[model samples]
Target: MPGPGSRPASEGPIPHLVLANVAKRFPQAASPAVDGVSLELARGEFFALLGPSGCGKTTLLRMLAGFEMPDAGSIRIDGQDMGAVPPYARPVNMMFQSYALFPHMSVADNVGFGLRQAKRPKDEIAARVAAMLDLVKLGALARRKPGQLSGGEKQRVALARALINEPKLLLLDEPLTALDRKLREETRFELVRIQRRVGITFLMVTHDQEEAMSMASRIAVMEKGRIAQIGAPAEVYERPANRFVAGFLGAINLFEARVVAATNDLLTLDSVEIGARLTVTHDRVLPLGTEVALALRPEKLSLARMPDSRWNNSLAGTVRGVAYRGEASDVEIELTCGKIVRATMANIGGARDTLDIGQPIFAGWSGEAGVVLEQ
Candidate 1:
């Protein structure tokens, strides 16, 4: 339902891989593990399946890797149906979270194991191994065993092994979860760079929201084994389809309202709790008296003591608490309606010095910045 107004060009080429009504279920459970999910990944695209644990993201990835079969629907790669094709037979490789490196084998042997399994000539396997190591910038560590390498190094070796086969689709399962936070952040950029350079299509499964937003060109957000939303990182974050997607992506302030008036580009909603009217932009048609929800991102709302610096929608509140973040501060305000709203303010030009807890202030946002959602 997002992007109804600023529609993108329809003539742009579609993705190379497509999933048509794919569904999966496990025995002994009433619900399906993957519940009728469908999506597409273009050639040389970086795509992410993002969700929390038990959201069916892993199950869908397993199906794509041929570890599990779908109960219905079809999966196509380059316009060819993948009907029960085994993992090895398909032109795809998966990088597991465990890395699955053999402790006894050196890095070179570990990366070359796939080639050896294919019965490639010894010289050919060696040459490919060398190239893979150099691609990952790990050629110097080729002689070391997995036991001697750090978590990040082991992950790189696993990636090199997965890429050695030059699979049409590369599936990564929580590839960076094993590393520390700082290391993971650094590796995400590296992964994106490597994928861009090779021009290979990547399908990554991860529960980290920031990871998906940063590394993927497009993301499919999953919930209860179904796709909740799919779009570019900015689109998904700014124009979520529902309350769940908005809350899951980041911090948000929500208010209950009912449509009091309607127009082509705007709708006036009467907030039940605050006893105020708010105007928002939307293309969806809702009759008057229809209930709706307003979502305001924390960063979009600002606070001030004087009502003269009027925002499009302003409400009086008292500062309940303040949490000082490194570059920004979270200000919690207790509204007159007994609802709490949070605003994030950058600590610039000594702004933090003027703020104090329990001070009465005016907190609001631009009408155009907040999004309206159907109840």
Candidate 2:
């Protein structure tokens, strides 16, 4: 798999938003805030710019909104160059993390604020505001002020306002950060539903992996001011492009190993981490004795009291801890090789649920359960 800063070829319909060689650098910074990043979004596609704090996701979004100009490269929205376009002139609307709703204004007034600023006809503004309120399911609360609404309600009002202008691209900057856990989870689906209903291309900037994975049709994983990989959520998660992408996206166990054997569609690695030979199904053959990293998701492992013959790889260990997470349990086992490996076991009724700390156990997986990274 390709490592960080590698840009894959864009594949899809004609792009509605095209960013080419976009870069930004702040004064006296050690490195560029955003570096030579290029991406494309098809019309009506929901895309996410995902990364940790200070990885340049927000900077890229700001550049897209025309609030921050790139030091180098070009941005095109609907085939129009945005180099000279100001924030208000760009065919985009940004919903800030703070929601930015007027405290004294009613929901209807807030939703209609954009049209009013544009000096739209009174009848048109009223009709559009009513339609938007209905679309967001907040029509009944139209007379309520911002303070009178719940976090989710205020978010809907903010969304309605952002879409009121009918921008070609909608930029959401941490849209659900203010909501509580349950409300944030509920709002994710709502945002996806609303985006699909309106058929507007949504480009959301968020640090929450679950939010991006569940809502965006595709995600661009950024690291150190550049794109590490861009693909569907499943692709990015299951087949990560590098060690950074694998470990950043979710909980995974990485093991250092060297190629012991290779075939047309498989690889055998002599792993020092587990003190066992690991087998993985891969497309290409690697040279014998070549160093590589083996990555496995915690959920891919199965634990038992005894080694299973069905698994192509197995490791004996002693259970160190088990954390119950309602639907499943996260198990940490100390292998005989002195490595701690994590396995996620579902809470289905079975002997596995009766596992106790410090008990002897065997963790096993099939040959296809792991990803071999060259880096």
Writing each residue's lDDT as its tens digit, candidate 2 over 1-375 gives: 122223333334445789999999999999999999998777778888999999999999999998899999999987789999999888899898999999989999999999998999999999999999999999899999899999889999999999999999999999999999998888888999999899998999999888899988889999989999898888899889899999889999999999999999999999876678999998889999999999999999999998888999999989999888878889999998889999998989755457899999999999999999887
* lDDT scores of the candidates, listed in order: 0.88, 0.91
The numbered model that scores best in lDDT is 2
Question: After aligning candidate 2 to the native by TM-score, how far in Å is the CA of 42 from where it should be?
Answer: 0.3
Per residue, candidate 1 scores C-alpha lDDT tens digits across 309-330 of 4567888889999998878889
Give the lDDT of residue 128 in candidate 2: 98
Candidate 2 residue pairs in clash (backbone atoms < 3 Å): none
Query: Candidate 2: which stretches are off by over 4 Å?
Result: 1-14, 350-352
Clashes of 1: 0
| Candidate 1 residue pairs that clash | none
Query: Candidate 1: where is the Cα deviation over 4 Å?
Result: 1-15, 308-310, 351-354
